[model samples]
Target: MYKGERMVLRFSRGQRVAHWALAVSFFVLLFSGLTLMIPSLAPLAKGGVARMIHRVFAVVFMLVPVYYALADRKGLQALITESFRYDRDDLLWLLRMPRYFFGRVKGMPPQGRLNAGEKIHHALIILTFITISLTGLVLWFGKGNLSQNEFLGMVMLHDIAMYIMVILTIGHLYFTFVYGALQGMVTGYVNEKYAALEHAKWLASIKAEKTADGKLPQSKSA
Candidate 1:
């Protein structure tokens, strides 16, 4: 894909590391969860193996955010702040989601570092993670320490969180694969053309800052 074209840093090394770590753990949990919840999937892992694997990844999933914050507090803070903010363009982006889903992004509104769909995805993940973590803890440690009603409530909440998480994860994968974003996560960089097209505003801000600092020359990529 590199034909001497300029490139942009779409993600940092730390960001990529944390993202992949969390993604891997999430997929493991998803598969194990499928086996635990469905009898037909039990052949995927047997002898309590799936549950053991799920627990191990659950710990990693719970810690990935803490690791990211410790490794790059500023980056994590910026991401969180952006995920909570919305604008007119965000609304437009969502309205035009059908086009995006079908790979017709030529006329979409310019996005920042994280696009509208990404912000929605992040918010959902955050919400579900909190709910799932709470319910998971209850299921793990509340055995015989709770009433039947409380136990059933926790189990129901946990199942609901998993449903949300699984659906979101599937959508995330679809967009990433369709848009060729996997390279950005793997290499921490993306083609300049792609970034300018999808995240023009964010790319412009970076260029402006670099120009102000006299650290970048005035060029097509700039």
Candidate 2:
């Protein structure tokens, strides 16, 4: 088994469970949603299976936000709150991040539990969920007689949203896989070195918690 010291519980068991549930649902929805996007692909006969799985997982996806809010309301609030106080240092850090990719920025900004990029990504996801849910509902069960033109408009909107989401999802997957950032979600903990380097402010919080308890908090290392 993997082991580590100076770790913190970034996500509770409930949060991790909810995250995985949503992730699985997303995969199902993505594949199923794709089948509907291309008319030529619809005639392949397996489109029905894809639609069925997508609809089932769409329902499951709804539980994610509920669980997250109930399980950790405080955390959720922190994640959503937008802070407007940005210093010149923050600007410098933002500009410098690209240098990190080229091994130029040796010591980047001491980030908080969530970095600026992560926060932006999270916000985009919230928007995506709202758009997808609303548009999907109209496609699935909207009443009132609509002209073919109106229906096509909704279909076009849904397709555009899905394509945008897919692009964002690809970026997310690249970060998680290529950069080894998925450990935070997969194991509920980040290594001390990683936390210190990437989330220094968060590491301070963990240290404070450890000091209060006189022991390190439990965490699963990837």
**lDDT of model 1 at position 60:** 95
Q: Model-by-model lDDT, in order?
A: 0.85, 0.72
Residue-level lDDT of model 1, residues 106-185, one tens digit each, is 89999998999999999889889899988888877787898989998998999999999999999999998888888878
Residue-wise C-alpha lDDT for candidate 2, range 1-222, written one tens digit per residue: 224555667777767887798888888888777666678767643737777777789888877888888888776677667333344545666778676545443577876776665665677777877778777788778636667887778778777777777787887786666557787798787777777767787788878887999876654444
Task: Please identify model 1 stretches exceeding 4 Å from their true place.
Answer: 43-47, 216-222
Sequence-dependent TM-score of model 1? 0.92
Q: Rate residue 14 of model 2 by lDDT.
A: 69
lDDT leader: 1
Candidate 1, clashing residue pairs?
A: none
